[model samples]
Target: MKDTIEGFLDLVKERNGHEPEFLQAVEEVAETVIPYIVKHDIYYGKNILLRMVEPERLISFRVCWVDDSGEIQVNRGYRIQMNSAIGPYKGGLRFHPTVNASILKFLAFEQVFKNSLTTLPMGGGKGGSDFDPKGKSDNEIMRFCHAFMSELFRHIGPNTDIPAGDIGVGQREIGFLFGMYRKMRNEFTGVLTGKGMTWGGSLIRPEATGYGTVYFAENMLKTKNDSFKGKTIVISGSGNVAQFAAEKSLQLGAKVVTLSDSSGYIYDDEGIDDGKLKFIMTLKNEKRGRISEYVKEYPNAKFTKGKTPWGEACDIALPCATQNELNEDDAKTLLNNGCICVSEGANMPSTKEAIAAFHKAKILFAPGKASNAGGVATSGLEMTQNSLRYKWTREEVDNKLKDIMTDIHKSCIEYGTEEDGYIDYVKGANIAGFVKVADAMLAQGIV
Candidate 1:
């Protein structure tokens, strides 16, 4: 089994040798999915996994726009239409300086399984650019988004590929991108998610991913006759995912202690209540300020510069930040600190070594594809609302989101249970997500 896995990875590495991030994502899935494929005769000799690893289409173009300095700037943009076997290409568009082919490919590959887990008629894709939106005037950001959509619009459509916001891309950026596509196509379609509520946006879209992460953790806790009530929760990132994860955790009677950014993390032992979370929403969403300002607002919270919150003792740790944010050492620290659960709110936030540590410890851990899928699931709902030319109320959307999370949790448990009665969520998620898409691909023939 080890040799077979290595042989497959060797071939994949041959083609994607330069793409470390993409290779990492593939290796993680291959480790778990390969065993299932080996045991299943229908999937054997089909080379389905190979086809899924490769993108159906990878589009790259030049985005040219004028900056506030009246100078022309050029940035590369990409859209990896990874797999459309189940449905149309669906994912988010990130606008950050770190955006690259490797990163996008990894995300697109992960999206395939994430969307499949959602039980939605949507495939996986990811598009983004290396354009940094920070420190830019609103006009500058708008111009950049417009330029990005000018070329991206040619490849995507309401039914072909619908993009939402991620990382640097948010409501304001989505508004500009959607506006360009609408004007160019001369139609107001759901070509994009994460739009303002007044313009075909779904309620709770921003909070979907965060809320979903907490919901998943809650479900995991239930398996052990546990709950979030009175638990000390430590979360990373101050963005939409972290903020809303804190909100939902607080709602469930949990104590959220930490929130961080690139600069550093702040530990608020007193817990980040609803009021503090609102302040953080303004600090990040409106002011676009650094997280250090949080310490000033609440002096009781100590700011730890240039570090993560893993060292703090807690019951649960939600890594809502970027990929590889939590390493093996961090995982060990969390385990040593008596942390019982670690749920990912960001894509591939936990490294391979870190995951192994958690598995060795046999603690409750949820991967991003299963835990962080709420964002894409909600986007799928938004697409449905758009197609019907109707909108659902907040309660309706929220209820649907919760049901989907619960279903995902059940799917994980169904496939992830081991002989020792311990749940291997990673294996369960990878296989559960794989069976649906692999079957769809097989039914559709060798596309």
Candidate 2:
């Protein structure tokens, strides 16, 4: 079994040797899914995993747009239509300088399983560009988004590949991209998620991922007859996911002590209350200011210029930032500090070593695919609402999101519990997510 897994990984390495991110994602999936495949005769000798590694479509194009200075700028864009075995391709479009084929492929590969776990009729896919939206004027950002969608518009549609927001892509970028797609296609459709509410966006879409992460954590705590009451949580990232995660944790009677951006993290021992949270929202969402400003507004908080919040003492930690933000040392530090639960709100936020450390410590941890699936699940609901030409109220969308997260937790437990009663969430998420997609691929007969 080990040799078989190694052989598969070797083949993947031969093809994607330069793509470290993609290799990391494949390694994690193969580690668990290979054993399951070996035990299940029907899955054996099918090369199903091999086929899944390859993208159904890899679209790369040049995005040429004019800046505010009237200078034409050129950037690379990509759309990896990874798989549509279970449903149409669905994922987010990230806009950052680091966006590349490797990162997008890794994200798309992870998305395939993540979407499956959501039990939604959406396949895995991801797209993005090397054009950084930061420091760009709104008009400039709009032009870039339009240029990006002009080419991408041909490759996606309502029932086809659907892209949402990630990283630098947000409501503002989605609006511009959708406007371009609408103009080019000559119709108003739910071709994209994260659209403005008036234009067809679903309620709770912005809060879904973060809220879902917390809900999943709550479920994890429940297995041990535990809850978030009076728990201290240290969350990284002040983006949409981090903010809402903090909000939900607070609502559940947890103290959210930290929120960070690229500049640094702020540690507020006072536990970011409603007023401080509102200030953070304005500072980040509206002012586009750095998290260091958080300490300025609330003098009680201490701002660390260039560090993560993992060193803080807490009962729970939510890594809502970018991939590989938490390392083995950070994991060990959290364990030493008596952190019991670590839920990922960002895709692949923990490295292989960090995950190994968590598993060693026997801590309750939820992967992003399972814990942070709310955003895409809600997006699926948005698609349904669009098709029905109706909208769900905030309460309706939020309730559905909660139910979906709960179901995902149930699925994870059904597949992840070990003999010792330690829930190996990684193993459970990998196997459960793999079974559905693998079966779909088998039924499709070598597509």
Deviation from native of the Cα of residue 267 in model 2, angstroms: 0.3
lDDT minimum window of 10 residues, candidate 1? 286-295
Candidate RMSDs in order = 0.7, 0.7
lDDT of 1 by residue, 1-447 (tens): 999899999999999999999999999999999999999999999999999999999999999999988999999999999999999999999999999999999999999999999999999999999999989999999999999999999999988998889989999999999999999999988989998999999999999999999999999999999999999999999999999999999999999999999999999988889998999999998998888898899999999999998899999999999999999999999999999999999999999999999999999999999999999999999999988999999999999999999999999999999999999999999999999999999999977
For model 1 the local lDDT of residue 70 reads 97
Clashing pairs in 1: none
Cα lDDT, all candidates = 0.95, 0.94
Task: Give TM-scores for every candidate, taking all chains together and pairing residue i with residue i.
Answer: 0.99, 0.99
The residue ranges of model 2 lying beyond 4 angstroms of the native Cα positions read none
lDDT of model number 1: 0.95
Candidate 2: minimum summed lDDT over ten consecutive residues — where? 292-301
lDDT of 1 at 340: 95
